[model samples]
Target: MQQWQRQKKASPKSQLKVTFLGEAGVDTGALRKEFLTEMLSEIERKLFVCNGDGKGKNPVYCLNSLDQKYFRIAGEIMSVSLAHGGPPPSFLREWCFQYLCSGDADHLQVCTSDVLDMEMSLLIAKVNDATEDSITDLTDEIINCGYTGVVSLEKKDRIVRAIVLHYTMRVLPMLDQLRKGLQLYDLLVLMEKYPDICLPLFVPVHSDDRVNSTFIMENCKTLFSEKGSVRRRQECG
Candidate 1:
């Protein structure tokens, strides 16, 4: 029985949790450094990391892209994330090849050239008034400037369900509109539909509300009121 148990322990059905080194508690600089450290830690498990600037650009963690055969050669997978900021920094790109993916031939990376902060709903919204030229320009902006990406995000939310009522009078696009409702929440929910994108780059922001919101994302202000922001929030709820 003992031997059987030991064998079972070594079975392929084992899972492990790893800290990808993001902001320890809300300190932006510390978060970057922490994540950098995790990137340097043990290289035995599969890693998925999200890279974003404190807010505007994608923060990135890559092994290598220079030598395209990294995945073919490296044993461990290193998934790079860019789900938040517009474009991840170039240094991260350079370093992916120079360090993570090169000398340590044990790692590989996954990359997609998309701004970390795109929403399907928002994209749909842009279709009405935006031209094809505008869309292409937007994509280019996202890739080139980095966080400087020209994301064509206009009225990101819509009350489609409410509009489809029997007695509900259909309203024209520009003619009828709700005042500032769930602008950021809708955007985030839309972004979250892409799990592949959010995994590696899940950075927690600070807020006084019980629920998190982009409107009050104070990455640096974890504890604003003496009442203890997060704690007080929980207590009140």
Candidate 2:
């Protein structure tokens, strides 16, 4: 890790500049497609690990402590974005929200209900099958190994969601801010040092004739519209 950090520090810096386009020049169709593609890819990657057959090592487990922190931060950012009327990232909607909550219910109620019971039961079965142990024994071992406690499934879901929400909220805005021309190397350094902003520090933002500053900014504004006090109170509380 130290060696990698030193190498990163010595790396050359790059910058990503984002600009907005005027209405006359904007192609809403192309922009929408690009946005959907990026979001879908991100969601699919996250869910693949959770739903994959027990075979090769899980990338989620392979992450170092710092990387894990960043991952959770990213999750939290997505959660807050959803709460503020931003579109819920596909992964959060499918994996965390769907399993943890029911339609029109609070997160707490969702966690405590039977929403995830079937999924958890299947997951437990898979674990026991792989480990050659009884379900109860494997569950106990899982708790003892410090992954999570033997609490009710809902409680466990609530805890996981809390961690996810925290990280996601912090990471997304930071990524958005990077469009203001932060050096790629500096961004990498920040992520490395903080270990809580899960974005890749070197994402390239290309601007062609078709996609300009107005388009980018307008899309962002539309997606992340400011929610006033009433919405904030309802969502946050």
Whole-model lDDT values for every prediction: 0.28, 0.33
* Candidate with the greatest lDDT versus the true structure: 2
lDDT of 2: 0.33
Top model number, TM-score: 2
Cα misplacement distance, residue 40 of candidate 2 (Å): 4.0
- Candidate 1, residues 94-192, lDDT tens digits: the string is 212222212321242222222232442243344345664665554542333223323443421122111111011211111111111112223223322
TM-score of 1: 0.17
Clashes of 2: 18
Error of 1 at 108 (Å): 25
Model 1: lDDT equals 0.28
lDDT per residue as tens, model 2, 57-152:
111322343343434334333332322223323332222232122221233222212222233435444453453234444455345334454444
TM-score of each: 0.17, 0.27
